[model samples]
Target: MTGYLVRRVGQMGLTLFLIITLTFFLVEAQPGDYASFYVLNPDLPPDVKEKIRAAFGLDKPLWQQYLIHLKNTFTGNFGVSFGHFPRPVMDVLAERIPRTLVLFLTATAASFYLGFFLGKAIAWRRGGLFEYVATISGATLFTAFTPAFALMMIWIFAFRLDWFPLWGNSCIGGLALDILKHMVLPVATLTLISFAGTMLLTRNSMLETIREDYVMAARAKGLPERQVRDRHAARNAMLPVVTSLVYSLIFAIDGSVIIEGVFSWPGTGMTLLSAVRSEDLPLVMGAMLFIGCCRCWLT
Candidate 1:
């Protein structure tokens, strides 16, 4: 286990290096200069550009800039935003990380577990009315187009129609009522969007799993169907699901740009989108790198 963990850590470090290297150079070495991000006044002297360059050490060689970026990154400094923000990159991430995590983790777990248990039920009683009806219903409710519409409809019904709050996290009050209120919409949207895919994946995985020799052998040995499925089938079936889940998670985070924007949630997803629109290169690149690291962690 220790050896395995060490190898995984090494892989994580390698992934980080690749991500940072790509993010740093790709954003820093973009086609146009970072100068346009400043006051683009025609009358502003070129000397001002030189001064700006000198201040940020942009006049240095690209290799030197790379070294500086790497050194600063190691020291927990994400460099000054090419735009006006005074705070470091880490500080911005710290502020927004919780919201993103809460949404993403909540959604992922909701999908994953529901997929697991529910798929088990469907499998245990395949060809029955419940399975047939559920499959049809799941297909509609969890269709790809549904997330945006579902969330919006929910907002309209739950918020505009005098139900739940239209926006924001309600976890602050620590009371069950408040927490449940805040979570209702986002959680429902995420689960609805994710449920079908997860369920389908689980159904397929479990179906294949149960066909394997061991499942038949388990039943032959008088092992209960529950034990056969949960112990012998579920774990083996989940391997592919786990692999699919990693990519789904990455895509989900990326897709959260749309979801978070819609909800006006103060998450890293929203922060990054705003930074990108503002051309805040450092923040944009920092967010990109952060997401890459998250992907690596999932991997």
Candidate 2:
């Protein structure tokens, strides 16, 4: 396992380096560089614009620029952000990363466990009314588009009932409770979206496991239903679910970019979107490369 992990980490690093290189060039290939913004400013003289370009190293060759980016990335300096100019890219990411992780990780965990138990029960009671209702609900949720679902939730909970705040991370100078209150809707939205898939997968896996030879043998020996299901069947069924859960965790780390944007929650997802819109290559490349590396490592 140790050797396997080391090899995977090395592969992940190489993959990340390639991703960084590819994304950098792609962004650079965009119609205009950051200096174009400075060029369009009427107040800045031609000499001042030239100086700005030189200072930003826009005057450097593409190969030289790439080399500088590589060196800075390895050294934990992601360069200055064009979007939040003068603020280092690393610093901007640092603030948003934690917020996104907290929100997404929590939602992922809640969805997984809740779905697991609910699915297990539904599968066990397959022909019952409870199972039918749960299966239908899960199916509905699975088919629902995330953004539309989030909007519907916002309309009902935030606008109509006024149960939760419409957006933002927290109120100014608010306590922990205030932050939790603010997060409820976004977290719920993410959880419900994730839960549907987990529930369906778990139900199918459990159904197959319960019909296996050992489960029948256990039942033949008159073992308790719960033990036969939990110890014998569910354990074996978990292999696929475990695999799915790992990928879900990785996605949680990268975050739900559109969901965060809709909720007005400050997170890496929103920051990355902002960076891309403003053509902040360093920040955009850094964020995308980081997420890609994380996904590679997890896989």
Candidate 3:
């Protein structure tokens, strides 16, 4: 186990290195650097722009800058944010990460619970009307376009019904009830879209597990149907579902960029979008690296 863990860690490190390198070059390949804003300013002279570039190491050669970025990343020195000037990238991310975590983690838990319960029910009664309806609905939802679905949800619930706020996250010291109310739409959207995949996976796994010899033996022993299903079939079938849950939780640290954007939620995904639009390299790189590290370490 130790050797296996060591190998996995090594692989994760290599993958992260590649991600960092590729991200750096791709951002560099964009039309302009972080200094482009200064370059376009009418009041700032060329010399002042040069100084600004030097201050951010934008004046350095591409390879040299890349090396410096790599070193800084390893040392937890993400430098200052271009978008949020005078603030470190880590500080900006620190402010946003908790919001993303709370949103996604809550959604994940709710979705998985709903999916597992429904999947177990449907699979246990495979030939029933419930199975047919659930199978069709789950497949449809699993294949749905996320952004369009999220928008439709907002339209119905927030805009037309006026049951919830239109968009935006809660205030820092807001009422708990207000925070939950604001969270309802985004969480529901995420849950509805994501639960179907889990449902389908669980259903398939349960189907296979129920036909196994152990499951048949449990039934043959005259165990109650519910007991046999729950303790024997569903329990064994949960392995893959649980594994997928781990990956889901890890990848969700990046947050849903489109959903957060659509809802104007001030999470990591929203912050990353703003950073990209403003060409805030340090912030962008910091966010990506943080996400990559989560993916690597957890998976």
Highest TM-score model number: 3
RMSD of each: 4.1, 2.6, 2.0
Cα lDDT computed for each candidate against the true fold: 0.77, 0.81, 0.85
Give the TM-score of each candidate: 0.77, 0.88, 0.92
Candidate 1 error regions (>4 Å): 1-11, 29-45, 82-85, 141-143, 169-180, 208-248
Clashing residue pairs found in predicted model 2 = none
- Candidate 1: worst-modelled 10 consecutive residues by lDDT: 165-174
Q: For residues 196-263, what per-residue lDDT tens digits would candidate 1 score against the true structure?
A: 77778888888888899988999999998888889998889888777777777876787777777766
How much lDDT does candidate 2 score?
0.81
Q: Clash number for every model?
A: 0, 0, 0
Deviation (Å) of 256 in candidate 1: 2.6
Best by lDDT: 3
Ranking by lDDT: 3, 2, 1
Ranking by TM-score: 3, 2, 1
Superposition error at 174 for model 3 (Å)? 2.3
Pull out the clashing pairs in model 1: none
User: In candidate 2, what residue range of length 10 has the lowest lDDT sum?
Assistant: 167-176
